[model samples]
Target chain A: MPKIVDHEERRAEIVAATMRVIERLGLDGATVREIAQEAGLSRSVLAHYFTNKAQILVTAHQTAFAAVRDRIAAQRAEIGDPVELLRVALEEAVPVDARRMLEANIDVAFWEFARHDPELRAIRLDSHLQAVEMWESMARDVQAAGSARDGIDVEAFGVETQLVIDGTSLQAVLFPEAMPPERQLAVVATHLRRVLRQ
Target chain B: MPKIVDHEERRAEIVAATMRVIERLGLDGATVREIAQEAGLSRSVLAHYFTNKAQILVTAHQTAFAAVRDRIAAQRAEIGDPVELLRVALEEAVPVDARRMLEANIDVAFWEFARHDPELRAIRLDSHLQAVEMWESMARDVQAAGSARDGIDVEAFGVETQLVIDGTSLQAVLFPEAMPPERQLAVVATHLRRVLRQ
Candidate 1:
């Protein structure tokens, strides 16, 4: 029998290598040659998998979002507390560990790149809308459960909470020592507690 | 009589021209040639004022920061109410207008560039510290005036406020339709009221 190739696995491997290259050299330096070398694959193989660098970048971005989404879903399933669910979701959004830090670095690059690329911009906007909706739903759920303070606008609170999370995550990446995991958690918790009733 | 040259004025002009180029074509596209064309000067003439593109970028970043600082100072002079001053300061930090939108664009580029360049990174770090200090002072002043809520940690509040400003500003740039100036101001105001005694 002939050996079967896992095309999905190969594509994932390429994306992982691309991320590593981006982390090391930034988006500007993440050339096809560099990525191929990092993946231990030839240029031809890379081409066979990805149409271009931008496609690879988009895939990488999607992958990062999916990872966070999956983590949030898993936590939501395991944790019955609405407050804990909100906390976990917010914490996962921040760059508290190596995985999240890497995601943040890629995100920074994509933000710059997306400024000019319409396709990437569309993807970013869509992803943002989805995340905001997710947060809004979660906030509503928490409020209904009586964990969040009454009379607070759930939609606005959700957006503001996300703004704080994004801002704190960016700061964490820019100033790691100043924004440690504990500090990030504290900042999120503080903001959440202030909005939510004790 | 020999024609006198104002070195500082010329440098500022070059920085302004560079910003135009950056706005038209992202940092990656804003090559030396493009900037020279945008400034209506020869490459040699451009070189006479700045060492390289990176130097010009750094100057542009500084100019953006100074513009915000000047605006805040002017507003502070005009407004006597402490709460109003704090509100205006926070509002100015968001990218509500075209000038701020341009600054936000340059900022996005600098953030990515800073990750690779230590000099740029140092400048970013220093600027952040200065802004945080400014906010902390403003928050303390407001608190002392008894307008702000008592018992709030001025330093943490200042830092968190800045984070919200930055995060909201970025979101404004990315999703202007979603986050209009009025919305941005409202979000900031909501967060401020939550932290301060209304």
Candidate 2:
């Protein structure tokens, strides 16, 4: 048997290919056959990694999600202010650029399936909860630093912040003309100020 | 060959059937043939009503949108307070229950197509523009009454209000446990208070 490292690498390759297919052709076009073609693997080999289309898609969703998280982590290294770091993360979360736009596209694709798939819903909920927790941790730092407004419900603020990210990304991805990237970034700024007063 | 009224009635019926198929089976399951079967019409008759699947889907989107608009209108008739009316309209916009859940499902299905179809994008943009105009009109009333905060950008506020609606509806529909109807309604309340103090 191959080492676990190679096993993980193969899965990552398939997930990346799934994203590419989904990105170019939308979710409906990303059939298992098409995804296998994009990944340059046989259906049998692909099946070994993922049990079904939904499983492949759930991993694809996590891939885009991880990219956003990594980008935030990279940017957060230079920023000392928790509120500023949170702002940057919120901005990174949305489809403000081609990279995040790809992520947003994958996310929208996931939402269509997550609507009906109970397992996908559970996976999405877990991811969303992690986002809330990450943001809440940063919010606590901001709160303790006395940068946030008085009586701010840090928990609600955390959840709402993620909601804004989700909502903004959906609009910006689906309706770029109406909610352009610049306007979206500006909206995030206003949202941050509303809660952080910074 | 039918009368204009009959033509419109037939189109509305087809649109309704399309939505039912879409809501039950999702956009991918919503086909020209399935929609025709759902409407109790032959595929040829469906063709006579709508030239293509995209046309039928666009009309289905309009049907769901009109439902939300009508529900808001019904409630607005009794509300003299613009802010209060806006709050109710916002609440009506999201999928707080079964009826609006159906509408939200239809909208989400439409969104999947709208992400790729230029024709659908144009139609969606037109519909969104009208919603912004309606909200701006109400925002003007709120501003005139001095119920809203000073220096509020009515145009931005109008656009952002719709963004919130889109975002909130999406989460409520896809992640109902995370964003229950009660929690969604409460978020809307906080959102409205942020915009309109009274």
**Index of the highest-TM-score prediction:** 1
Q: Over all chains combined, what TM-score does candidate 1 have?
A: 0.89
Query: A29, model 2: CA deviation in Å?
Result: 7.1
Q: What digit string (tens of lDDT, one per residue) describes model 2 on residues A88-145?
A: 8878877878877878877887887787788898888888899988888878888887
RMSD of each: 3.1, 3.4
Candidate 2, residues B64-179, lDDT tens digits: the string is 88887787788778999887888778788777888788777667767877877888888888888888888888788888878987677788777777777777778877777788
| Reference-based lDDT, residue B198, model 1 | 56
User: TM-score (0 to 1) for chain A, all models?
Assistant: 0.86, 0.90
Residue-wise lDDT of candidate 1 within B9-49, one digit each (tens)?
Answer: 67667788887877777667778888888878898988887
> Which parts of model 1 are misplaced by more than 4 Å?
A1-5, A13-41, B1-5, B16-41
**Across residues A1-198, which tens digit of lDDT does each residue of candidate 1 receive?**
222357777777888888788778766787888988999998997888776778877877898889899999999899998888888888889888888887887777677668768889899988888888888888888888988776778888768877887788788878776678888887888877865875
- TM-score against truth, every candidate: 0.89, 0.85
